[model samples]
Target: MRNIKLTIEYDGKRYLGWQRLGDYDKTIQGKIEKVIKLMTDENTEIIGSGRTDGGTHARGQVANFKTTSEMTLEDMLAFFNRYLPQDIVVKNVEEATERFHARYNATGKQYSYYVWNAEIPSAFERAYSFYYPQQLDLARMEEACEKLIGKHDFIGFSALKKSKKSTVRTIESISIEQEGSLLHFSFVGDGFLHKMVRIIVGTLLEIGAGSMDVSAIDEIFENKVREHAGETVPAQGLFLDEVYYR
Candidate 1:
């Protein structure tokens, strides 16, 4: 069997998320798997680097599947793009080592959240960005971002109720850039739990809006209480920007 790596990009506004749940539910994985079955006659399982929440977008989501077919990678890529829905695109395909597992071998991930910080919301970008009419303090948000960087337990910021798996993850960097009426937030992290990035972004926004103190970030980290954290922002603003592997 040959392992094939796929770099995918999707709008994800209409799908139920990345994972395939049942035959009826619309999903990114389910759509691609259906195409693969038509091409190879195998119920191939596509293992993704991570799951993106419903309505979330992705620019460079990675997945892998093993196949017994001898089709060329170029043919496979073309086949996927041809059969899959218009919203999901298989950007690239490559032959991967047998030992390569998309989820396990992934070293880190990059995610970005966008906020429309203008009084007049953007009509075209409504589906892609969160609209916040309030003016935000960029300096305060930057200070909160500094407190979130480095290794820390992020359970407070995640939606997970309980788990034995370690919630501690390393956030290498968080950058906030403002261009016109848009605010772009980027995060590079070893890993993230469910809704972790959204929650952190919400917290930062609150701090910027003067509703929450910047020092509250440290308290949330030290207390490890989910209630102490800010709301989990809307999924539409979040994007799985890239998956890192080495």
Candidate 2:
């Protein structure tokens, strides 16, 4: 069998999520797998780098599947794009080594959250960004971001149920930029727990609004309590920007 890797991008407006559920073909993974089944006549199983929550878009999502088809990489890419929906596009496709697993081999990931900080919404960007009009203190948010740029147990910021699995993760970097009424929060990390990025952004928003102090992050980390963190923000504004493997 040959391993095929795909670089995909999608607008997550209509689907449930990336994971395939039984025979349910409404999800992103199901949609792509359906197209694959039609093309190759094999019940191909595509594995994504990670599971993105519903309404979360992806610009550089990576997926891989093992197939016995003899189609060339170029033809495979063209075939997938021709048959897939316009919103979900296969940006690139190539052959991978036999042992190349998308999820297990990932080294790091970068996620971005967009915010529309305007009183009047933009018709163009309303679908991609979260609308929040309240005045925010950007300096405080930056300070909080500085504190989060290290390895820590982020169980308090995740929505995952109790598990023995490690909740510790390393945040590589954070960049918060504001331009006009648009605010972008970018985070690079080794890995994230469930809803970790959205929850971290929510806490930063609270800090920016002066509702939560910057030191609250320390308290949340020390106590390992989910309730001490801010609310889980909406998923529509979150994007899987990139995944790295090395």
Candidate 3:
């Protein structure tokens, strides 16, 4: 058995998400699986590092699958690129240890949320970035971000009602950068709960807009209540930049 790892990039606008659903729904996993089946004529199951929500893009998503094919890494990459849809691309393919598991072995991930805060919206970037007309106070947003770094209970940021696992997660770093009319908020963390990043971004946006103070971030962290956090930002703005493993 050969475990193959793939670095994938995709435009997530049309698909339901990463995971494969029923035949009625189209998904990223399903598309890859279809192309795999076509290339190797083997019934394979591909597992991703995580499930990106609908409309969320990915630049360096990692996935692995076990296959019995005799195809080489180069052949597999070429075959996938030829067969897979244009929206999704296989950036690289390599053989991995049989014990490799994409989700379980992941160490950390980095995500970025892009905001277009200019007067005129670009027709091409509208699908990938969130457009905000208001002027955001970047310094205030950075101050709020400083409070989020470190291990903390993020129950307030997640919307998963039945999430029984501990919400304590470590955030290694968070930074905000601006170039021209584009503003990017990036975060690196060990793991994240469902909708946690979006909610954090929304709350920070509120702080930058003067609708909420930086102290409110602390209160939400202390309260561990979802209602105390700001709204969940749109899914289009979030992108899974990379997944790390050792």
Candidate 4:
């Protein structure tokens, strides 16, 4: 058997997320897996880098599946691009090392959240960015972004129900950049807890809105409680920009 690795890009607005749901064809992974089964005549399971929440997009999502078929990589890529939905495209397909487990081998990931902070509606970016009419304090937001750098226990930022999984996560760096009316918050991390990035962004929005003091971020870390953090931002604004394996 040969392991085929794939790089994918998709507009997540049309699907229910990356994982294949039971009996649900409206998911990105489900759609891709369906096409793979149709082509290979095998109910092969594909392993994704990680789960991206519903309506969350990806530009460089990675996955792998083992197959005994003799189809060339070029044919595999062509088959997926031709048969998968218009919103989903497999950018590349190549043979992977036997031990290259997508999720298990991922070393880090970079996620970006886009905000259109303007009164006028952006006809084109409406689907990819979140619109916030209120003016934000850029200085305060940048200050909070600094605090987010480095490792921290992110339990307060996640929406997962009570579980034994550790909440400590290392955020390598953060960049908050604004060009015109678009505010982009980018984060590089070893891993992220469920909804952690969204909640952190929501809390930062509160700080920018002057509703939450910047010191509240420190409090949230000390408390380690979900209620202490900000509200969860919409998934449409989040994107899995890159995944790092090495």
TM-score for each of the candidates:
0.99, 0.98, 0.97, 0.98
Off by over 4 Å in 2: none
lDDT of 1 by residue, 132-161 (tens): 888799999999999999999999999999
Winner on lDDT between 1 and 3 is 1
Global Cα lDDT for candidate 1: 0.93
Query: Compared with the true structure, what per-residue lDDT tens digits does model 2 show for residues 1-246?
Result: 999999999999788889988989668999999999998999988999999878899999999998999999999999999999998999999889999999999999999999999888889887888888778999999999998999999999999779799999999999999899999999999999999999999999999998999999999999999999998988889999999999
Q: Residue by residue across 1-246, what tens digits does model 4's lDDT show?
A: 889999999999988898888979889889988998998999999999999989999999999999989999999899999999889989989999998999999999999999999989799888998888788999999899888888888887799767697888999998899999999999999999999999999999999999999999889889888998888989999999899988
Model 4 has an lDDT value of 0.91
Each model's C-alpha lDDT? Answer: 0.93, 0.93, 0.91, 0.91
Model 4: CA > 4 A from native: none
Worst 10 residues of 4 by lDDT: 154-163
- Cα deviation of 49, candidate 2, in Å: 0.3
Backbone clashes per model, in order? Answer: 0, 0, 0, 0
Clashing residue pairs for model 2: none
